[model samples]
Target: MSEQRVRGVPAQPSAPDGPTPKRLPAGGQRGGPPWMGAGMPAERSLNFGPTARRLLRRLRPQRLHLGAVIGLAVVSVGLTVIGPKVLGYATDLIFTGVIGQQLPSGTSADDAVAAARAAGNHNFADMLARMDVVPGAGIDFPALGRVLLLALGLYLAASLLMWWQGWLLTGVVQRTVFQLRAEVEEKLNRLPLPYFDRQPRGELLSRVTNDIDNISQSLQQTLSQLLTSLLTVVGVLGMMFWISPLLAVVALVAVPLSVVVTGQIAKRSQRKFIAQWTHTGELNAQIEEAFTGHDLIKVFGRRREVEAAFHAKNEQLFQASFGAQFISGIIMPAMLFIGNLSYVAIAVVGGLRVASGAMSLGDVQAFIQYSRQFTQPLTQVASMANLLQSGVASAERVFAVLDADEQIPDPAAPVRFTDPHGRVEFERVSFRYDPDKPLIEELSLVAEPGHTVAIVGPTGAGKTTLVNLIMRFYELDAGRITLDGVDITELRRDDLRGRIGMVLQDTWLFGGTIRDNIAYGRPDATEEEILAAARATFVDRFVRSLPDGYDTVIDEEGSNVSAGEKQLITIARAFLAEPALLILDEATSSVDTRTEVLLQRAMAALRSERTSFVIAHRLSTIRDADLILMMEHGRIVEQGTHEQLLAAHGPYHRLYQSQFHQAAGGDDPMPVAAASTAG
Candidate 1:
């Protein structure tokens, strides 16, 4: 937007500078195709600690719910831990009852033990002495039944509590993930366009889609299990010491060894998990690129290269995933082996203790059960290390987006343009894509209200870049641009862009009915107004031939429609918007000569009372333009009317001669390069 707007008193509204269309071809411009998933640096991890902490912070909002779940887990584990001990009492009752039935009536327990000793069974006598059995009494069926019933109740209660906690944990975990996904989406909207320019579209989508999903799955599988397993370990350990301290000590011996095994393997698997997710994102980016540019790929005949790239990425993902799973897989069996060793040691020591009258047979039985319970939870935790690592890796990617630099915030009190007169001015404006390479420098110009201004420039001559400055797609490095005598930056971006209508060289039509797509320009537009635009742009003409007419559905890529037809629809969309300022870039390039003539006529009507900035290569179309600008190397080398520029015989004259001279079958010294100006 050069000579774009100025600070001037209200003047009679003439018309916007004419022909606001660009002429650059679709290549080498910073504006790559919408579907091209290229560029952008990947998110790398220095440590999972912060990411893991951040992931847990997502649960902060659900702390109350999580607390309730933890409470239930603790109660459930308490009941579960007490179960084996209660069952051990029941076993003792049965054993003592059977032994008592063999004794004489009314005999003392001491007498039974002495009799066993007299029979030369010293260990058996000692075991019998440790038991609280009456020699004369038969099986105490009532007491045994009560012990069995109590054990069953405790186990049933534990299972019910576990189910309830799992249900609650599911809700909490899902809600946390839902909020995380929403945050990522909100963060994307706040990021500047430059951020998107640097990042691959597919990598971004993976962070939003795949990474979020993996977090949800990982939390759901691990949170409650980890909570319950930890509680079980503590409760079972306490119970083990209560039953037999010697066996408990034996069980404790495996803890450090299990820790060492898990720590060593987990360290190896974490890196693999990170690589696995990174490769997954790269592979996804490639697939999205291949699918979106499928037709282009086929035309270029680089199918083999695309396939090889995909194969390489897919193989990397496979290797990472395999390494992560395989390394973590060893933890479970290693834990189980250690656990079995402890179990055997406990059994042997407890058996000797029971025979020596130091512990009861019932206690020994419970001690063995506690040892198994203790090891089982440790194994579960060790096995879950891979999942935790993978989840944290994904969390780091998502957090990267959330932590990215956002665009400057909109002003609290923004200037409003109730009636923008389309007076755009660039005052000593300077900009550069790279810090070292300057593009436009100290450019000053003004586009008067309601006059057609055509900008003709060579490729990379900062034509589109000028319009981009007006649109604030990139922040200006120096100087300022204004619309309607007000600084563009002073206005809300939405308020500024809402008043301008633009059509690009590359047509974009989302999946929808023809009517809906047209209505997209102005959702509040009336049916009559919509049809009027279609008629003016000549869309209504060909649309009538379709069986569905205005109701005809278009796919995402608009593959069902011809290129010219799609262009017509977009033109109709711009017309329907009824914008105060019009910026058209190669608006008529896709049409046939007949349609181009009609579109030019329709564009003239559209420009009747509006300010327009047109970037044009077809000098014939802009012959009637009020002000013509010839730009080379980002500076306005020449500025005048068509007839005036022809008289001057400068660069614009050479550019003009190269075009019409060839059309008339007359050779000019200078050849007309295909469409001048960068996009």
Candidate 2:
């Protein structure tokens, strides 16, 4: 039989979800029309300037492509801005042709203009003197056609180049975003387990998924447009000044006004944009928890409570999104109003200059068009401030993840484990989840090759922490742990973990066939070896009963199978790995008594000629173990054979008596004095 390919993806993620961020007590997001942009749903100090700079740096690799895109934009804007002035020439041609045709055919230019002045058409005479037209000319169709065709060619070329620029920019921006995602994925893997402990999976996923996606979209939509608009402003400003300096200065008055207005709104709305995306992440976390814990929520009949929480988060998100959009939305209209005021002033001044013959009528016409063109780009820039703010906010969140503290790196020259012995030891190992509250302190122990060490402890007694330290999931705060007398830190993490196999208390299975999941432990396992592992762990019986047998599909959450079935599959996986050292933290607690006995026999065979550590509350399973260690409050209180510990009547004895007595249908609660002493 061919082996099925299994994905490395983990199960549908959601264990104990973290709490939502605290909601603001009052002020920012109730839509009270606080024009100063006061009340915020939630707020944090975002490094806006630095984050935007970092985002720009992501485009550095595409500098050549960016240069080409910018060059295209400049050429396109130049041609587009020149169109109005060229069309104004056509307007002058028609006006001068009509005026000259109304005069006598044999008249000279000086006599015609003198006649107009004598007839009290002084402005008309001044305009005629300014124009260059033949005395006998009517309309010159060929000349007019040439000017129109020239205008058409300029605009057509500009449009084509603009299209090319947009296409090139799309490729450049997408490539940059692709690189950013790869970096983010690599960063997630390098972060330590404790970092994950501090972050909720859903929130982390949001930064990786939603926030990065927002950044990509923001760049794609605005980058090209912003470049074009700014370039257009420069092109139009030059044209306006060349036409008439007076009207150009009149148009320049609106720039500072627009800048001041936009800056005020932007400064206030940026924090709101940050709050908006934060609310989105928090809301996403709540939804993920509610989805994964749907069964638990229903079983506990806390449906109303969950709904109420969802409603509150949903409302917070709505308020924040609305505030960010509405406050920033004001920029477009405010800018348009300022530009209009400048437009009216320029129009009034240009007309006076044209009537005084200081400017030609065609120049005044082109100047009006230039003023509109100049103000338009500013309006466009103001309109995009919200999107820019939103994207920067998301980028800041993603940057935070990338900048987090990574795990202590592997040694430069790692020690090789050519052939691992089963021996393991803790040399005065001290560690804690928190510095102020020590959990494990100066604890030392040893396990000889081919020995079984059964750890018996109540909840919160550091049983799991001990095993985790063995795996190097969390670094020790002090002291050292070793395998075969060499410090574990000296060995590469993968090399050390490769020699150890673990079956954690929480079972996880990816989306794959049963065969694939079992083969995940050793992808090259033979068919016979896989069947042997399945039979040994009691998974064979249930798997054969399924319609697809070993090929039966397991959902991402493994929800189609029973909990015991999932546990059996994971055990079979560990068995197939065939590592030198084994750690089982309540590996068989899910199976029934009938199945437990069979697993114990299989485990014993597997434990033979190898080292193993078993953690269990069921005392009967570890009775024949070579050594037994009882832990309390992060310290091992006793270690000996099971019989020896029972004779000693220590905490292990009290725990064993309570369990055995219960099995025999009798109450054997520890005495008050004994419990106090144990504490």
lDDT of 2 by residue, 1-679 (tens): 1001112112211121112112221111221111112223444577778888989989999999999999999999999999999888888888778877887888888888898899999987887788776688897889999999999999999999999999999999899989999998888777666566545556678888999999999998889889999999989998988888888889998999899999999988887788888777777767777888899999999899878877877787788889999999999999989989998998899888877677877788888888889999999889989989999999988887788777788899999987788889998889776566667789999999889999877666677778778877778878898898889999877777778777756788889999989988788889999999999888999999999999999999999999989989988988888888888777887888899999999899878878998877677889988898898878899999999999999988988876665545545453222232221
Worst 10 residues of 2 by lDDT: 1-10
lDDT of prediction 1: 0.80
Per-residue lDDT for 553-664 in model 1, tens only?
A: 9999899999999988888888888887887777788898899999999999988688888888677778888898898777899999999999999989988876667656
Candidate 2: lDDT over CA atoms? 0.80
Cα displacement (Å) at residue 320, model 2:
1.0
| Candidate 2 C-alpha error for residue 57, in Å | 0.9
Candidate 1: deviation at residue 606, Å? Answer: 1.8
